[model samples]
Target chain A: MLDKALSGSSRYWTWVIALMAIIGIGFVFWVQQMIEGLTITGLSRDVTWGLYIAQLTFFVGVAASAVMVVLPYYLHDYKEFGKLTILGEFLAIPAVIMCMAFVFVDMGQPIRIVNVFLHPSPTSPMFWDTVALFGYLVLNVVIAYVTFGAEKKGIAPPKWIKPIIILSIPWAVSIHTVTAFLYSGLPGRGFWLTAIMAPRFLASAFAGGPAILILLVLLVRKLTKFDPGLKPIFKLAEIVTYAMLVNVFFVLMEIFTVFYSQIPGHMDHFTFLYVGLDGNTTLVPWMWTSTILAAVALFLLLVPKLRRNEKVLPVACGSVIVSIWIDKGLGLMTGGFVPTPTHHVVSYVPTLPEIMITLMVYGVGALILTVLYKIAITEREIIEQVK
Target chain B: MAKSTRRGFLKLAGVAAVGMGAKPVYDAFARRSAPEQPTPPAEALTAKRWAMVVDTRKCLREHGCTDCITTCHLVHNVPDFGNPKDEVKWVWKEQFEHGFPEQHNEFMSDDLRHKDVLLLCNHCDNPPCVRVCPTQATWKREADGIVMMDMHRCIGCRYCMAACPYGSRSFNWRDPRTHIAKIDEGFPTRTRGVVEKCNFCAERLVRGEIPACVEACKAKALAFGDLEDPESEVRDLLSRHFNIRRKPGLGTQPEVYYIV
Candidate 1:
């Protein structure tokens, strides 16, 4: 089965070699990070967390997005998603793995990650986040393996696995919710202290995550002979639309509250991001670009004619992903730190080493996903042959 | 058993009698309803929740109090960056305007030009860092109410660093071992990419020693003591002089008090 799948790609080795080279480059950068410390990163006291954490935040959403297709197909009995759901599940395995890796690289001591379990503090949101992330990873991997094994046998998945599938729908939501709690629970950073943070995170995750997945499905269809039906893709796009609307609404609500009360604590962060505060104007362009992209993406997605068009659909999805990446990933983390308690502006830029390590982490995730997808595709081909 | 030592036997009997007599009294106190007596004055308590009072008014920015920062960093094995970008400061001096933006008034002195005040972790009564830390790596000690970071448990997500409004937390983006070769071998160097900050010298506190910064203060501008104890030196200082906390409007209720 594996050999059959390998035969389908004449240039498979070339792709593998290229991925290996990228991974190797990333390894050298990791060594640099270990030796030089985070000083090699653009982070400073003002922006203590930068690209690594931002990417982690973004990918957690991607992992959760797997549920958009998984729930409808597995639980709702949406047969249109039958062929595509496996891809989503397989994609989640590597996405979650990357989520964990991003977090690992962000840590000062990755080995001490075990201390979270050893001496757990239930009261801390960080503890709950760890629990949720690890739990979700376990669930996704277990469910994927079980489903794949059943598929290889040309049989319905075991009765016991149905409950796991149902449980995963909520678990997917929990992972992103807990990740948001890691931010919103903070008391001093007024920007992150909002009650709506967790919900907004979920909304944004549902939006950007599914959009990326839709784009991925198109890529898979183009590259591979496997054709997941267009109906499921359309439905997923609809889900992305609603999620994006909620995300945009929640952001507007934040803006309204900030402007309505005119409270310095709430308004200061917005001022720093959109308008310069104390003459510091670094994030203004980024914020404006995100705002405009979000608007354009929403406009394109809301129109049925535009959203249905293949060319327009990918563009809309890509725009939303980039917009949310900026809004939640870069803007959210950095904006929260601006106008520091001292009302001083401190900037964070990802240094070359930090960027390289980030690229390496991404490559690692892609490599894992590529291997997993290859195996699943081979197994499907074997089942087809047996039939 | 050999000689039936009378002194030893008597001592045991005396201890048993004291234990027996004290049992009912202890039980009675435990079983009794709440006392009707008024609460004791805040100052009379001995086990004071520790706090720091920074006299920003006396902060010269001529680098007078910088010795405190340097000594504390040296003692804690905090990394020294020859460049500002790489600097991971547990304590440092910030210009007066940067330190007290909300407190700016026209009446303030021109002599205060370029005046800087020593800044470190505020160790808030309701620290966001403590609340956000997922691994329980950062915690507020119940004994003295000081916010501390346990580096061993920290996953270095920088959540606490991002959560802190004061910018007091620092991340060790690279191995801090290189910079700490001169420090005492007892203090451990931090790994790359973990968040670290002033722990109030928790080790020194256990040894009944003052934080290195307090001991090194040239102008006697920094004070540390139990805030919960009304009679503690910090409380006394607070009462004797007007003081402000960094970002009080945020309502973190910082234990670090600055007198201007």
Candidate 2:
């Protein structure tokens, strides 16, 4: 099964090489960051966290979203998803890896990372996050290996894997919940101190996660002979539609609660994000763009005609991914920091080297994803041809 | 039958016992003939819970005085990057509106409205920084309630910084050693990438000396004493004045109080 990734067409090799080049460039910048410290980044005392943390947050949702496919296929015995579940599991493997990479790069003392485990504080959400993420990653890897191997051999995945598959369902939810706890539990951070944070995270994850999966699935269809069929893709787009609707509703809920209650601590952050707080409006344009794109995505996904149209479906999925990307990856993390606890507004923008390092982590995720997908596609092609 | 002789014998015995007791006292006095005496060291300051009170009335009376800030930064070996972005501060001055934003009002007295207030780590009794620290690098000391930072253990995740409601913590964005104007050999300078802040002068308290900031304030605006002790100065001050802590509604129970 591993040998399949090694033997590929020139096009496959070109894609692999291109991701490798990105990984190489990113690695260099990461090393430079290690030497020079986070001073090279656009972070400050006020905005202590920035791009790395936001990416970690967004990718965690992507990793957890795999459960959407796994749950329907495994629990309901949905045969239409038989081909798509493996894609979901393979997608999770790199998403989790990207999450780990982002956490690694975000640390000021990356060398002392072992201290989290050595002297673990159960009180800390971050410690629980580490445990949850690592556990989810292991669960997906084992499930993918066993199930995919059984598929290649044309036998049932051993009886033992069923319980493990069921356990992953909740584990997926836990990873994102714990990640949300990392921010939401903080006392002074009014933006994240809402009961809806975990729900919002899951909703956005379900929307954004499957949106990316749809794009990857389309890419697989174009590059390989293994088609997952149209029914499963349409079903996933429907899931994206509802999840995105709920995600937007959660955002509106926050807005209503903050504005109605008229708490300066809570209202100030939303004001900073949507409009300008004081004179600083760096995130205003980004926030509005995310809002408009989300509206566009919801519009595309809601209409059955546009959604089923393959060409327009990809456009909708792209819109969902970008919309949620800006919402979670750009706005969410930085918004919490602005209108700093002191009531002074400070904005953050990622530096070039910081962006480079972030891209490097993404490149690593892409490389792992490409290789895993290549292997899965080749196996699916062989099985279809024999049938 | 021998009463006369027995009485004389009893009297002699009583005199001998009295002489025996008095002999050691006389000997002790004769041995320490010198006037000079060795003095024992002052006892290390101990408090069930340490707290500070900033008398804003006294603090603002003298304008443009950074005595406390200078002394604290110098004593702690805090670096000056000459810019706010990379600045590492232990004790610093913050404006009244910014320091106590919750307390700020539109129609406040002008004297109290725009005055500069001294600010440092609140060392909250329910410190969120301690609770959120993944590595247990920052913790509220069980003995004195001072939030302690173990720089070596901090992975520089900055979760503590984010969790701190008062904005008390500062991260070493660069090598702090590079920017220190003069290094204090007594206090260890922090390396780049670890979150650090005011330690409430735990080191000074061990040597039976007060915090440098409190000592440096010429106006005597800063009061440091045990919050738990009813007899302590801070406790007495809190009882007298209408005081406030930054973001007290958050329930962090900040030990630092402002005497409004």
Candidate 3:
């Protein structure tokens, strides 16, 4: 089936080459980061995490979103998703790859990363996250490959694959929940300590991940003959709208609790994000932009007439992806550190090397995504022709 | 390759369940009672919960008095990067308003408002850092409550940094060796991408000496002793003065105490 991908037009080769070029540039910077240390990034002692972690958080959502398609198709026996389930699973392959890569890049001692497994502490959320991510990656890879292989052979998927598919639904929820647990369980960080963090992570993930899926399916329709159709796409749009609504509601609840209670420790972080905190307002503009974008996205998605319009659907989905990316990827961890542990306001901005390295990680994800997607589409084309 | 039978799956699950319970059951039998008096000549291991007392009056907010801080940094080979963003401090000075955040008040005495306080790792009994450490790279010593860091084992994820409420831990963003003008042979300089913090002078303690800071304080403001010993100076000092530990209400049970 991959042989079909090998014999692509110059256009496909060009895209692959472009991703490779970006990856090469990223590799050079990565080497520099490893040698010069994370200091090359804009990260400070006060804000220990910066660009790499944000990317990790964002991709984890993307990876977990695979279950949205898988659940409806396998559990509910929704035939519309049969053609598109492989797309979600394949997209997850690269997303999980990116998730793991971002984690590696963020490490202070990348070499000692194995210590998490070798000297495993069941108590640490990081350890559990390591488990959740790697496990999810393995599950997706197996399910996608086996199902596609069966499709390529023009046979029914093996009966045993059903259990693994069933397991992935809860596994998907666990991945995001565990990622949320990473932040929410921390004792003193004012911004991330709330109980709603895990639920909020899932809500945004359900919207953001599926939003990417809708966009990817559109890309697939244009790039290949495998059109998942307007029916499946419209159904996905509905999921995105409802999930984003819940996500927005959760954010409002957080705002009410933080502001109404007026706890200085908690209020100070929100102040830094929305208003300036002690004259340090680096993230103020970005926060407001996300808020506006989220509102516009919910407005566009909630209106059924606007949602059905092909032109408006992409716009709504793109807004959701951007909005959550800013919320989870950029502001979530960094905002929590404001009025630092000592109650001093400090700021962080990613440096050029950090941004380059971050882009390289995305390029790697794109490369993996393009290859995996090409194979899935090629298999779909061959299977349809035989039928 | 037979299909996995329900009986076989259940058997595997049963074994895994028993394996998980084995550790706790063994520990229950193996656990030792708290010693009334610390075992003497236990230099190779830790003590019965180390604690400290900071006498703020004797700490002396005098001009340019960094006897404790300077001694700690110099001995530990802690680098001074001169940039706050890249700064790596093992132990440092902070204002009362900043260090004791919950205790801040606008109508407080002018002197207290301007007061300088020494801050370092609390060595909490229920350390959030330890609980959050993915690799157990940082842990509380079972013998003493001193939070220990296995620098070689640390992945530098900095989750522990986020978990700590005191801003105590510092990460080595660059090769820490780059910032040091001179080397201290007694202490091993840390590599880049590892978190470092005050260890209650765990190294010096093993040598049967007090913390470098306590010994170097000209004002004799620092006190270090075993909390388990009723006659120890730290315990005696705590009994004599009404001292406050940072974020006591968090229930971390910090071992460090300060007297105003």
Poorest 10 consecutive residues of model 2 chain B by lDDT? B1-10
- Model 3 steric clash pairs: none
Task: List TM-scores of chain B, every candidate.
Answer: 0.78, 0.83, 0.83
Question: Which 10 residues in a row give candidate 3 chain A its minimum summed lDDT?
Answer: A378-387
How displaced is residue A99 in candidate 1, in Å?
Answer: 0.6
Alpha-carbon runs more than 4 Å astray in model 1 = A1-8, A381-387, B1-47, B61-65, B74-77, B101-115, B177-194, B202-209, B249-251
Q: Can you write out model 1's per-residue Cα lDDT over A318-344, one digit (the tens) per residue? A: 989999999998899888877676777
- The Cα local distance difference test for each model comes to 0.79, 0.90, 0.88
lDDT of 2 at B157: 95
TM-score of the A-chain for all models: 0.96, 0.99, 0.98
lDDT of 1 by residue, B1-260 (tens): 11122333343445567656644544454442434787645434224477888887765565454788778888888877676666788888877777766667678786553577788888888887887676677788777787888765677767777778787888776667777747777788777767888888777776667889988887788888887777778989899998888878777888888887
lDDT of 2 by residue, B101-151 (tens): 888799999888888888899999999999999988988889999999999
TM-score of each: 0.86, 0.93, 0.93
Candidate no. 1 TM-score:
0.86
**Which candidate do you rate higher for DockQ, 2 or 3?**
3
Docking class of 1: acceptable
Relative to the unseen true structure, what is the C-alpha lDDT of residue B5 in candidate 2, on a scale of 0 to 100? 28
Candidate 2, A262-365: lDDT as tens digits: 99999999999999889899999999999999999999999999999999999999989988999998788889998888789987989999999999999999
lDDT of 1 at A201: 87
